[model samples]
Target: MTEPSTKATPTTAERIRSAFARAGGAMLAVEGLEPAESPVHHLLDDGSFAITVPVDGAVAQLVVSAGQAGVQAVLEMTDYAPLPLREPVRSLVWVRGRLRDVPASEVSALLDLIAAEDPNPALLQVNSGNGDTDRDTRYALLRLEIDSVVVADSTGAESVGLSALLGARPDPFSAMESCWLQHMESAHREVVDRLASRLPVSLRRGRVRPLGLDRYGVQLRVEGDDGDHDVRLPFARPVDDISGLSQAIRVLMGCPFLNGLRARRL
Candidate 1:
């Protein structure tokens, strides 16, 4: 049987959703309001998200006033490698949309739905009868109807439509990216060095380090006396499984064509 190709691009929505899901909290900004940090309480199916804020805060008041009319807002979230390294930020996802408040009666069901999928302790505190009696009145749950989504990383930034995002799945390696990158950084110096040999002569003089890894390829950060440069080494094909990933890495290490590509990019 022929192996299926794993080199599929993640939809803008999928990338945004993945980043949002991984982010502990997001920076939220309303068109006419100040930016605030809010924890993501839940992500709905329609590319929308639920976030909590103090009921008495300016954000709550603005959202309440907007009501069904919805207020224009933007949410920015980022993914970072857990390991301590220079430029650990892996990718950034930005979401722009209409924001509105969830009614008191609907909050319970919404919270329940989110809990069923991914239970968060924060969600419990605001659940109907769990924590403070005045929790309902003290906290506000706002939904963002995503209008557009964009994701940026070492590769580049691209905009994604809501429909494409909803249909695309995140790369299989998305969850494991940090762990593998960390492992390579900590234990696989030789491998990284060998890969660096494939870079153009101009970049070889710099100190090369593994920067990022995804299903599509591996990136390296070359630090030189002059400055730093990032170069991506694309695999012969994308790999979803560990074995395939290993094979792809071997191909990248052995391929001469990459030298030309790297030279062109420089």
Candidate 2:
């Protein structure tokens, strides 16, 4: 079994990347244009993102025209757990960049590469004149060259640099976070209650819910009469795998001093 280590904290970029990848959809807004909500197709490692839009739609038209002038665009992605927590929104990532159409010749190769990393059936629909023109012409692919990133979550809001955003990797437990959080909420009420007991006396009066879990720590949402509070229960160390995560949880539960650390307003 691997042991947890308290060596490093997750950077803003890693957190943003994780949120971006997990988000099902995002609100894409261009300057001097209406915001359109679309499904996020893929997030490339180089900090570029691909989204699908109607070929003749307002967004597509704007992107094509603005690609020449270098128009500014923003992609807003929200991270929410599938579980029924009081406040399910875990984080928000705002990616600001210039939008442009990928070259026709490169679309297939790009989609193939994205599919190889995170396969989506929708990628198959973006054909380059090999099939029905009607079906293929209905949609277009747009790429955003990421310039700046801003993330808001329990910790707070801050602007992250492009290099940091490009270099960071998502959390090791990103894929399993939703499933584990849902399981804890559904089948482990008693465990949640026990964990809630570790909260401050003033916070104990309200309804406590498990908010999020990561390699670093567990977060709790306390719904008080005044308002809602998010508290992070830091682990003894950083976890990289399931066994290490389990040990961190045990250490958090057993040690009284290891209770919730920073309390941030959500």
Which candidate should be chosen as best, given TM-score against the real structure? Answer: 2
- In model 1, which regions exceed 4 Å deviation? 1-14, 127-139, 154-156, 250-266
| Candidate 1, residue 140: lDDT | 63
What are the models' TM-scores? 0.78, 0.85
**Per-residue error (Å), model 1, residue 164:** 0.7
Model 1: per-residue Cα lDDT at residue 244: 75
lDDT of 2 at 137: 39
TM-score between model 1 and native: 0.78
Clashing pairs in 1: 13-165
Q: How well does candidate 2 match the true structure in TM-score terms?
A: 0.85
